[model samples]
Target: MYPERFSNLPEYAFPRLRALLDHHDPGGEVVDMTIGEPKHPFPDWVPTVIADHSEEFGRYPPNDGTPALRGAIRDWVARRFGTTLEADSQIAAVNGTREALYNVGMALFPERKAGQVPLVLIPNPFYQVYMLAALSVAAEPMFVPATRATGYLPDYASLPPEVLNRVTAAYVCSPSNPQGAVASAAYWEELFTLAERHDFRILSDECYSEIYRDTPPPGALEIAARMGADPERVVLFESLSKRSNVPGLRSGFVAAGPRSMARIRQLRAYTGAPIPLPLQRVSERLWAEEDHVIANRALYAEKFAMADDLLGAVPGYASPEGGFFLWLPVPDGESAALRLWQEAGVRVLPGAYLSQTVAGENPGKEYIRVAMVAPKDKTARGLTSLRDCLYR
Candidate 1:
C-alpha cells in the first residue's frame, strides 16, 4: 500500500551486479572494475581548507550556497564553458549531481503537458536518477535508445511529433555514463533546436565534462548561449567529484534560467541537505584550481592507453573518448560478467543492469561496462586479463 511509482523498478545496477557475481570464487587475483568511483588523489590543500572552515558547521548552511562558493562556481562555468552566469540568480550549489538531477524533474516537470500526462524523456542506458526523478513526479517516462547506432547519444529528434509535443523535459548525459560517448557541438545545436520547437526543457548532465581524452565536450549552457536560446532551455549539472577526486565531498552545482532556477531552489529548500560549509569552502578552492584535474586527466589518459594496448585488436572495441568507463561488447552481458568474475577475477557491470528491456531488446544486453578507475598497473593487469579471458 505504498506508492507503486518505483515499486516495479528493477534492482539498481551495483546490487544487481553483486547478486550476479558475489557467490562465485575467483579463478585468479581479483581486479574489480565495476563502479566509476574516482581512485585518483585529491589536492593536499583540501584538508587545510576544510579545517579552517570547520567551525562554520555550527551554523546552518545557506540554502542556495554561500556567495563566495557560488561566485567560484560561476567563475568556473565562465572559464570552462565560456558563458557567464549570475551566481545568485542562476546557480544552486547541490549536494551532488544525483540530487541536482532528481530535483530538476521534481521542480521543473509539470503534471500535464498540453492537457495530457507529460512525458519525461530519458536515455535508455542512462543515469538511474533521471528515470527515478521522472517517476517521483508521476511523469510518463520515455526511454530513448542511446545505442552505437546513434553515436551513443539518444536520438530525440527521431521521435514522433506527438511524442515531442508532450515532452516536458529530456535528460542527456555527455561523456555519457557506461558508453563515455560525448555530444558534439552540432549535436547540442540540434538538441536545443528540438527543445525550442517542442517547447520542452533539456536536463544536461555534464558531471563527466572534465574527464576527456583530447577535446573537451561541448557544454549545454555554452551551446545555448551561443545560439541565443532561452536561458531556461538547458538546465546544466556539474560536480567536483570526478574533477577533484572528491566524490566524498559531494559538491556540485545546478544552473538554469532565473525562473527555472528559482523553482529548483524552492524545491531544494524543503528536502535538500546543504553541502557542509567546510566542504563548500573546499569546493570553492577546488573549482579555482585545475592543476590536480590536469594531472588526474593525464593519469586517465595513460590508463586508457594501457587499455588500448591490451584490447585494441578486439572487434567492436572503441576506447572511450571521455569519462572512465569502458562499454565492452559481449555475447551476453550477465553471462560475460559472470565468466569474467569466476574465470578471470575481473569484475564489471553487465549492461542490462543500466538499460531497460524495451520490446524484448535490452540496449545494454551485449555489453559489459568496465570502470578504469583503478591504479595504472592494476588497470593494465585487469585490461590484459579481460582481453586474454574474453577477446583472445
Candidate 2:
C-alpha cells in the first residue's frame, strides 16, 4: 500500500502539462516555454575543472562538503550578502538546494509547537516541495496567499495569534518562482519580526537571487544579520543552477546556526546524496568568478525587455522583477494554456497547477506561467505569439 502522506498530492507540473498538451498537433513550429531550464551557455572552463578532479570521484565524497568547496561558498556569501559564516559550522552542502529544502523540514520541525501539532507555513503558488516537506514532518501545511494585493509575497502576520503560535517554520521565495516579485529589505524585516514573535524558523529560497532586473534583491541572511536576529532563526538555500547556468551540477549550500547545521549534516550522513567531488570542485570555481554571472544576468535582462515590449499593452500584464518566469493573467489558466498550445504552438504551465485550492479559491486560477529561458529571439517569438493568441 502507498503511504497516505502523498495520496492527496496533485500530479507534478510537467507531467500534468504533458497530459494536457501532447495529444494536440502544433499549429506552428512548437515553442516550449514551460520549464525554467536555462538555455544560455555555462562557462566553457567548467569541464576542464571537472576533468582535473575526475580521479577524486573514485573516493566517496564527504557527506557534508569539502573544506575548499565550503570555504568558497562561505566567501561567496560574505561577498554577496556581507554576512560572515564559518564554513565548518554554519554551512552544509547538498546536491542542489532542492534536496536541502525538502530535507530541512525532516531534520528540524518538532513534533509539537505550543502543545499542538506544528504548522509549517508556505506561500501559495509556491515551489511544490515546500508543502511536501511540511507534510513529511506531519506538520499542518498552511497556504498563505501571495497575490497582487500582497505585493506577491506571503503575509504571515495576517494569520491569527493561535495559528502563529503553532508555526514551527515558514518557506519564503524571494523574487518568487512564477510571479517574480522580490522581497524587499522591509519585507524581510517584517517577516523576520513576525517569525521572532511567533517563534518559528524562516527558510529563505534565494535561488533566483542572481537573476534580477536592476537591483540585487536583498537577502534574508543579510537582513537578519543587520537586525541582530538569532542566527538560527533563518536558514538560506542557494544554488548554482540559476546563478551559474549549471543545473546539472546539482550543487548548492545551506547555511544556518551551529546547532541546526549539525542536525542537517547528521541527517546528510545517513541518507543524503552529496554532490560528486569533481562537480563540487567545479562549483567552487564557479562561485569565485563574477564575470560569468554578470554576463548571464545581462542575457536575462534582454529577454525581460522583450517580454515587456510584446505583452506590455496586454491588460493585467506585469513584468517579473526577477527570475525568468512570467505569471501572465488569463480568463482561465488551463483553458488559456490549451488554446496557446493548439493555436500558437506555445507551451506554458497553468498557474493553478502550482497552487493549492483553499476555501474553493485557487490563487493561480486565472494565470499561466511562461518561462523566458529560451534564447532571446525564440523567447520573443513565443511571447509575441502568446500575446496575439491570448490577449488579442
Q: Report the lDDT tens digits of candidate 1 across residue range 96-157.
A: 88999988888999999999989999998988988889898999899999998999999999
User: Model 2: per-residue lDDT, tens digit, 88-117?
Assistant: 999988998999999999899999888899
**Cα TM-score of candidate 1:** 0.99
Quickly count the clashes in candidate 2. 0
Off by more than 4 A, model 1: none
Q: Positional deviation of 130 in candidate 1, in angstroms? A: 0.7
Total clashes for model 1? 0
Task: Give the per-residue Cα lDDT of candidate 1 at 380.
Answer: 88
In model 2, the clashing pairs are none
Task: Look at candidate 1 and give me any clashing residue pairs.
Answer: none
CA RMSD, predictions in order: 0.8, 0.8
Can you give the TM-score per candidate against the true fold? 0.99, 0.99
